[model samples]
Target: MTDTQPRTGAPAKPQGFAATERIESPQGGGPGRGPMVGGMVAQKAMTFGPSAKRMVRRMRPEAAPALLVVALSVISVVLMSIGPRLLGHATDLVFRGFLGRRLADIPSDQLPDAAKAQGVVPGVGVDFTAVGHWLALTLAVYVVAAFFGWLAGYVLNGVVQRTVQRMRQEVEEKIHRLPLGYFDRSPRGEVLSRVTNDIDNVSQTLQQTMSQLLTSIMTVFAVLAMMFWISPLLAVIALISVPLSLVVTRTIMKRSQGQFVAQWRRTGQLNAHIEESFSGHALVKVFGRQGEVEDVFAEHNQGLYGVSFKAQFISGLIMPTMMFIGNLNYVVVAVVGGLRVASGQLSVGDVQAFVQYTRQFNQPLTTVASMSNLLQSGVASAERVFELLDAEEEPVTGLDVPQRDGGGEVAFEHVAFSYDPDRPLITDLSLIARPGQTVAIVGPTGAGKTTLVNLVMRFYDLDGGRITLDGVDIATLSREALRSRIGMVLQDTWLFGGTIRDNIAYGRPGATDEEVRAAARATFVDRFVHSLPDGYDTIVDEEGSNLSAGERQLLTIARAFLTDPALLILDEATSSVDTRTELLVQQAMAALRADRTSFVIAHRLSTIRDADLILVMESGAIVEQGTHDELLRADGAYARLYRSQFAAVEAA
Candidate 1:
């Protein structure tokens, strides 16, 4: 391949995790209530079946409580459903007394017992006692229904809380099992969004939507059944509206679904852009690209507005359209019931009950309409979460790896490796480092310097050949076992939020305070720590931003010294320090390297002149290997690199 051409490697590909929308949360916003803009504003249309099924399977443990909630909800709704029918009887009793009509073609036995009782005025009668009795029964049913409703909510909340906690735990555990390559390829913000935003979406849905959905569904079926029982004619009239409402809902959703998808996808893209722009703000300003950056942001903002407006507009139609259709059904039911009542084909009480049932029927339809967007957004978030959970994890092969001898001898025997198997980066590479020797590797950028370090750490499995440490195959060793015996200090230092003392003792978590201080002193880190106001107790913020780059490097070196591992890997460890600090660091490093095997990957050829072995690499292969002076005498790749660096320094 030409230098400018790209090379394809592995034919095998890892599963692609879905990109999630960047939801902008309002201050103190809790889950579903959060004010989302951009991607969150638009709902993406996608099938939620797989994700929903997976969630249901995972929620099996909480099935009993869910079922209990369902049962309670059903009982509460059934009691409430009886209220309209009983109230109608009370209305009919009063109407009968006023109209002076008792015996009709309808059977007297079908009438309530209260209606059959004699009135005080004989023909011109009022059944006061019967009305009171009917009123009392209706009130009792409602009171009991209210109690059951509250209990159902209480049980639902507990179950949802426990289930959400379990989901969060699983996601955290999954994070630990994912390979380092996954992190390397994926954006940290995107991954974070899944863990926090997407999971939170699921939690909110379970807590709020689950109950509402169950109630709406049950209410619809109960209302329909009651309507049919009252009069099949009015029930048919209500059923006509169902098809019309569904048609409207489906049409609008078909349009809004795509927009929702666009909104969320664009939202993720917009967030990624903002993150990149902010991170590289200095670079943008230095290159006078502020206007360009603004233009880019404006373009993204405009795109979001267009898609979100469309999505909101389309979804907004659902409630109003359903409402209009439901009212039309209501009008027809009322007119037809009135005619039937006048003709004595239906009783006044039956007409009243049917009207109430019609109104109740529309209620669930309205609820379902209003909840359409929330359900869509929730399902979208769920799918994204499930995608993450279903990602491929690092396999654990519990093979018995023989323990390495104490010598720490390392060897690479004809190793053939490639980042992409289609194009080999390193072919038939061979190297050996006897115990207690300092081996320096110098190479240009893209020469696979870091790749070598990655291999030694077993960050990626080798495609072919074997790497042995003291004659024990590294592949046979567990990653934890192999890595525990090695200590590494890289150019890009990392420090967590903790005290300076804690950072120094990171590699050896069990080290006492004195042991930590001793390690720091050995690395000359104590010199700086003592100068600080808090000394060893000084707090280091995340990434050690409070400390200078060189100081961060110093702390990492101290951490490595604390472990005193058999094998040490230093990658440009002193590149950040000044000349004076560099000299001191070098002195400390020399003492630390005593009787320990070390591999120093350096750009500064001068620092490794005294190394027992120097491997000069170019294009992923070592072109020269020898003592520094011996390589200089040979006048090859190493000599040219050294001469060029020295020339540049002298010229400057």
Candidate 2:
């Protein structure tokens, strides 16, 4: 790729400059493409059964609201079940009223009772008054049932929302507790998809399934009770379809569950592909990778489409199939009820109630069966979320040291570490920086220079040994307490969307306007700010894309200066700026370094030459350590690097 992204894309592999090497901290990546993109990396995702149960258990904190929703659902279903029976009574009244009119000419008692054994005497005429009363009661029952159903739905919404809100907060907090190695090993897109897309899917799934599932289950049981009460013979016929319904649901659920897993897995991959492509778009174009990127995107898209279609298609068959089975049961129930009514053993009203109960029972079966799709998708997303919450977190520090009030002494004691257990990096390395010393670290790419500074910041814990600040073991200090008195200006300059003045003051929150301007002037940020139309008030976009590299770098310098920290770690902080601006920043940095312990990482030729100590590292160990002149006198690693590097620059 001919074009290089400004430290934001996965840098084109450290092309002979510290600028390109900025993100090569063995962990951090530009944009969202972190070092490793392990799909289900390093761990197996939880299976559906456990994940579904876990999802339900996550709502334990919202138990009160959840219980209320359950109570409402029961009330709603029980009320709704009564409506069918009342309507059946009205139907019987209407039929007897109409039939009685035709039999008016015959004497009353000699004629057979025409109320179909309902206990009403053979009538001389229609009874419109009784039918009206039954119809009114049915309407009132239906109205009340509808109200409770809506209330249940309303309460379920809040319960699901609060549960998801807590979930989002936990995930956010977990991100901070994870070790830098986690990001080093997992792609940024994969993590984001789990955080955002997967969680959102969980919310939607719960919203769609929660109240409806409750109502369906309640309706199934309650309606079955009424059916038995009306007629045991007809109820038994209806019960025959229960086993058939269970078999269909269980088979389809088992098969479609696997499809859902594949569907989400493919979604994560597609998201990763899109992220890497967009972050490195300039490189892709420079290398004519449009077709390659598109082809890969197409591949992932097709994979997702195939799995999603299969999952949805399989789940969709449930509703109609269940309906078909219910219809068959409906036929048997209706025929049997009609026969009982004709034999005069059962009243027409009772048979009418039994037929209505059959329809109500089947409706719930259809509903619960169809909801299987949402349930599968929801559980799949829940498993991914659980995987993150279950990730091993950084060891929690148990003690807190007071913040360093002045220039701090930092020491690294026999530190041993590695990203992978099999491949060791930075083993048994040791060093110390006295208060007010300017210690410079110089090395080639992958020489463990950035790894050294990272140790001081505690980005990764040592596999062995300890780091101490001002005689206090940092491992005993809370991470925040230890980092409180330190300021870092990395080669990768970052600025948020804020005023230029605010960006500079970020180094020290609550600083006065006067103090902010002082730091800005000291770092030459004010020099350029005055030339712009909005000056300090101009709003910079995220990462300061509107400003030049040197401008962004200077603002970061101002931020570090504003803090006036006891210890400073500048990792190639001046590499992005121009020569004149770098010189000014070095002077400002020199003043800033006067009483504070500062660790400066840079190429030997670029750093302040009057450094009190210089360390040359190779293959994760320091091969040489001394002042610049003393190292040159030794004619060792430092001397050779300077001779080779400076000699080439001089010739040019």
Provide the TM-score for each candidate, comma-separated: 0.87, 0.92
Q: Which number leads on lDDT?
A: 2
lDDT of 2 by residue, 515-600 (tens): 99999999999999999899999999985878999999999999989988889988889989988888888998999999889998
When summed lDDT is taken over every stretch of 10 residues in candidate 1, the lowest stretch is: 15-24
TM-score attained by model 2: 0.92
Ten residues in sequence with the least summed lDDT for candidate 2:
1-10
Model 2 spans with C-alpha error above 4 angstroms: 1-40, 106-123
TM-score between model 1 and native? 0.87
lDDT (Cα, tens digit) per residue for candidate 1, span 183-295 = 54455555776788777878887777777878888888887888899899879988899888888988887777667666655665567567667756768888888887788
